[model samples]
Target chain A: MAKLTMTVNGRTLSADAEGRTLLSDFLRGGLGLTGTHVGCDTSQCGACVVHVDGQAVKSCSMLAHEAAGSTITTIEGMANADGSLSTLQQAFQDHHGLQCGFCTPGMVMSAAALLAENPKPTEAEVRHHLEGNICRCTGYHNIVKAVLAASGQDVSGVGIAAE
Target chain B: MYAFDFVKPGTLAEASEALSHDGALPLAGGQTLIAAMKQRLNAPEKLVSLTGIPELKGVCAGDGGVTIGAATTHAAVAAQAAAYYPALAALAGQIGDPAVRNRGTIGGSLANNDPAACYPSAVLASGATIVTNTREIAADDFFQGMFTTALHDGEIITSVKFPVPQKAAYAKFQQPASRFALTGVFVAKFADGVRVAVTGASESGVFRWTEAEAALTANFSAAALDGLSVPADGMIGDLHGTPEYRAHLVKVMTKRAVVAAG
Candidate 1:
């Protein structure tokens, strides 16, 4: 076992996990942050996506011990301190970006990270950026629209309903 | 994943010592090793992660060439193109996705030496040098076979030295599901010679297309590769494509890459 100390969702978290414990397993099993799903144990699926040191990564592919000193952010960290939805979260709801919500958390986190880096991305850029995050629902049409909407644009013509 | 002992060595010496141990695996990005472990394919007893060794991560430009630290992420290499190596920068940008690029290290990818990997083609075409702790291996001799490399136990790749090319291009037909190249070709022209490498085709791993290289050496033109036929005997055959299909793709991609390089 190894001792891990890091900040998660702005809280300084600490734990002792086995070397084989994946970051996703540690977050979901130990800290009870089950919002990060595990669609495929392989790195192919982005359902376990999270921010490590402010960069998006697949937590399943990383060991919890490797993330000892990193600052991690998950879907639970996106809301305001008062529990209100974030701008991106609201845009998802407004544009119907989600269907079954299985891939929502990962999609939202990836989109949030993209907008944080490049606030304004073209439709093609958005599609390319979100390629890792697979959504079986909504076919990603509205998700792309939600990202554009959060960037302060109306993407209704891009097959998404405008708020 | 099977239970394993993990150690983060702070120095290359310490990491090397750990790697020298029996059944020890050096972990770079964990993009491939960890996934294989989770699937119960490889269960190493000890995992020595090299992330703590800062010396293994950076891009240095000198003497008309660029030496990239083995641990350098694809995103870092891709983002630093205009100031360093432009052709390499472009190749790194097209690997996997942003998340994979951020975590996947160049050394890890090359060390894994997946037949369909993108970097092997680029490195081979550019005639890069693989710098190991013990010795340097030329690109032509580095990759031995699928998921196999020339790296001996206790020998860790420190960096890859690439000679700056006059012109280079990588063209690949990516497997839509995995984003790995179903057929990829990298063409590069240097001061003295033109090298062309084809990856994601042969079961024997990356191999130089002598016909394409000879043609390009004589005349670096798309028309140069028009009549050459890559042999289908040793190419990989799988669900994505057949050996003959991959052979055809090697020529098509080579022509496109030559045109792109020009």
Candidate 2:
């Protein structure tokens, strides 16, 4: 066991964990931050994506012990200081991008990472970047629309616009 | 995953010392290792993480090529090696996905030597040098078979020195589900000759297509491969694809790679 220290969602925190504990388990099971979901724990389904040191990574694919001393941000951190949804989260609502909504956390995290690197990604680029994330509800086109809308692009020409 | 002792060493010596112990596995990226552990398929007594060692991460361009540190993630290679070797960098860019690329390392990919991996094709086709703590091994001598390599248990790859080709490109037919190479081809055209390496198709792991090399060396064009085809018996036949299907992809991807290289 180890006492690992990391800054999560702007708060410096410590968690007692074993070497076998995954970052997802550390967040959900240990820290009780259940926003970081784990759909397919094998890393295929990107439901557990989170920002590690400002770069997105699959939480399940990493060990909490490996992430010690780094800064992290889960879905719980994607809100404004006033506790309202961020632009990306709002876009997901406007576009009706989610069906069951299980994949929303990872999709939001991945979109944030993409915009951080390529702020003005094309529609095709948005779809390509979201390939890691799987939403079985066929909520893809709307999700792509949401990502583009979140980037402040004129997304009216793509996907179903809000009524 | 089973309970295990995890140690992230700050130096290569410490990592090597930790790995020398019984049932001690050196974890580079933990992208593949961690997933395997979740299924209880891999239960190591201890894991010595090599990523924290500064000496094992970065891309240094020299000798008319690029040397990528073992612990350097695919994301780093895609960003750093772009100016030096665009073809290799492009290959690194499309591997897995945004999250997986951020965690998976070149050294871990080459060391694991998965039959469907992308790095082995690039390394074998570029004729890169796999540098470890003890010695440097040629790419030809490094990869043994699927999930096998020439490295000793305690040995860890420090970096890979790739001799950048004048014209080189990789074309992968991705397994839609995993995004891994279903049967990828990497073609490199040097001043003297051409080298072709195929991955994801062969059951014996990555192997060079000498016939394709000879033909492409004579004429560095896609037309030169018009009549080439590999035997299906040696290809991997899984639920994703049949042996015959993989064999066909090898030829098709090779041609596409040659054209892309041109």
Model 2 TM-score on a 0 to 1 scale: 0.98
TM-score of chain B of 2: 0.99
lDDT by residue (tens digit), candidate 1, B16-70: 9999989999999988889899889999999999878899999989999999999
TM-score for every candidate vs. truth?
0.97, 0.98
Per-residue C-alpha lDDT of model 2 across residues A1-163, encoded as one tens digit per residue? 7788889999998879999889999999888899999998999889999999999999999999989999999999999999999999999998888989999999999999999999989999998999899999855888999889999999877645443
TM-score of 1: 0.97
Candidate 2's displacement at residue B237, Å, is 0.7
Interface RMSD, every prediction, one decimal place: 0.8, 0.6
- Report lDDT per candidate: 0.89, 0.93
Top candidate on TM-score is 2
Candidates, DockQ: 0.85, 0.88
Off by over 4 Å in 2: A160-163
Worst 10 residues of 1 chain A by lDDT: A154-163
Residue A47, model 2: lDDT of 97
How close to the true structure is residue B156 of candidate 1, measured as C-alpha lDDT? 91
